[model samples]
Target: MGIPRTPVRGVAALAALAALSLTVTACASEKATGGGGEASAPSAVGGDGVKTGPGVTADKITIGLMTDLTGPYASFGKSLTQAQQLYFEQANAAGGVCGRQLEALVRDHGYDAQKAVAAYTEIAPKVVALAHVVGSPMVNALKQRIETDQMLTLPQAWATGLLGSRAIQVTGTTYDIDMINGVDFLTREKGLKSGDRIGHLYFEGDYGESALNGSKYASEKLGLTLVEQKIKATDQDMSAQVAAFKAEGVKAVLVSVGPRQTASLVGVSLAKGMDVPFVGSNSAYSPQLLPTPAGPALLKDFYYMTAGTPISSELPALKKLAADYTAKYPDTAIDSGVPAGYSAAAIVVDALKKACEGKDLTRAAVVAAHRGQSAWGEEFGTIMDFTTFDRPASLLSYVAKPDKAALGGAVVFEEATTSDLAREYRVPVG
Candidate 1:
């Protein structure tokens, strides 16, 4: 289960990678034009006769996205995509990025890494960058392509195993760091005491294990007892797991699986008369959880932690996003994932503008612009320089309690916070 982790690139490695991108771009240009001068490279309209990258034409700059539109995490994927699509549309209406309108090319991986990799392969050569890549499992599968292909990806998952590649950009805290802060919040606010029995339900892959490591570390540090169980990301029933936790009389539960698993655990436990708090990791929450039959049950005991501020936040950036979203799609409900998509688009837009400033836009130019950033903000949190191998750019998460009145929306009670354990956390790079 212990695969070697990837290490982050330092300044020298980043420059080397950037140079690789440029070199690949040049080679691709040569190949596409039959040894002609400056062809297949993305070029500016009315300025140059040469193109720079795969998906950039004079009128549009396309971005590729892979997500679970019909799989287990379908709700989050759908909502995230909606936000991204609408945001880009709004941006284009006012003024396009670098004089070219932005376009989103989407593919559904159905939560399967194999399919995700295939989809990525099919679209990798047709876009300037990846606008969104969902799921930790998908990221695990795409690691090599990201590192070698210079296909910059904006990932929704924050597992540490996928953090090493400079091509993949993470916008939030790693699952491990989020859990450390999570446990700290539990101990301080929920009166979770030393020696108390806690249960964790997680998937058996990188994403789940990343969060489990945090809970295990937190238990050792806080003098608490952790009883752990593993499940698959696609698990739909958890009666046995609930029974096991019930038998052990765990005071609270922590989950690192998807929303279906979380719902099953909470619902089954309640039906069995073994009720307890079930705190969820970012991936374990979705707005769809509220309308389910388990909604009432969750209202009694569910809590969630997110690496970014909620879409409902009063911050100006979030306010503009929420306003734009509602104006475009008035009937659609909002969730934490919407802001995530919005922030990622903002970052991509920022980078694209920088990369295209009085120069031809290329994938390498985007990479260089991203690496050159000393400080970056998506209006949700500060992004650390991945070029420096800062594994977790930020080590904080916002904790929220469910609001029954709003159905699925949560009232964020705590701002993103970091504990001493989180600040010093480290994980292996594959």
Candidate 2:
């Protein structure tokens, strides 16, 4: 069966309408407080006169980790959780912040929206901030509640639509920015030219739609045709999408789905003799795929864009992180999530430290501290400025390819960069 096609113009129009709706929802909501109204009241007072609120105590501060431990992205979530756990352990050993030991409260939502909402509801009153929330849809489902509760959160997902909430901070370049850069790489280095038809296989929600926004913009700017295949996160097979792309005579394909989908897309495309380069959103690739049957095909033509440095980077900070992670986890295979998790934890830690210095450790204070950060983490990958809430922390991305011999099963092919188009692109904040 042939896949139904929506005119590119129609798709772009719908995406614009959706973005406008999200923007209004984000901007018109009641401004978040220090804590969810009553929850903002100080729970305890430290000897140093540091005011505290929910999740803060005289002896400890608790942060929540809402992740997908048993879901489709389990590999990414588990590695992210482990790396965060390691960072928290290290922080606690170093006497923690604000004279209190840090605690991580982990809850598995399994990538279910209802479960994520339930988990957030149950855990919100107990955490001053979230170290990391794993999925874009999960984050979107909980955005209003998070705003009402005034909890500071760092999301692992980077869809641009998630912006506008002061409480939710995306630590890296947004999906749209990454896609713009990816398209630039294809045009500049991969022999793609104007008028070439390209395929985009994306999930149906915020993550994929946001990425589509970039491809649409890039297609128009570069005089290319974009063929889009929208899928659900639950859909793992990509044979149908591959067939559609092949029928369209697309020159290359971009994926904004999960690792399973990426593997299927690459493997099926190769099998069908539809051999074209595949570029994917960061979440679309996992190191675990390296040992799978699709591994060789992925290595041949697949690359991904990321806001964080690859785990195999030779930077001193990354090297130390790898060594420490190996020492701590022992048997767990290191992946990109190691640095991604640690970088997020580091961001939260920096905010907490800032809040501590001000002697106000309330949830609101932490949010303020985060917003006050103008520059952060050259040690992680790219430097990020969190001073603004309507934009991503950074616009740079690292392009990486799979490598079985690499610690993370991937290595950086291009260091952090923001193409002219990426820099010129105005991300939709809604």
lDDT of 2 by residue, 324-374 (tens): 999987766677778888888989988999999999999889999999988
lDDT of each: 0.71, 0.81
Writing each residue's lDDT as its tens digit, candidate 1 over 33-63 gives 1111122343343455433676677777787
* TM-score (all chains, Cα) for each model: 0.85, 0.89
Best by lDDT: 2
Error of 1 at 11 (Å): 55
Model 2 misplacement above 4 A: 1-44
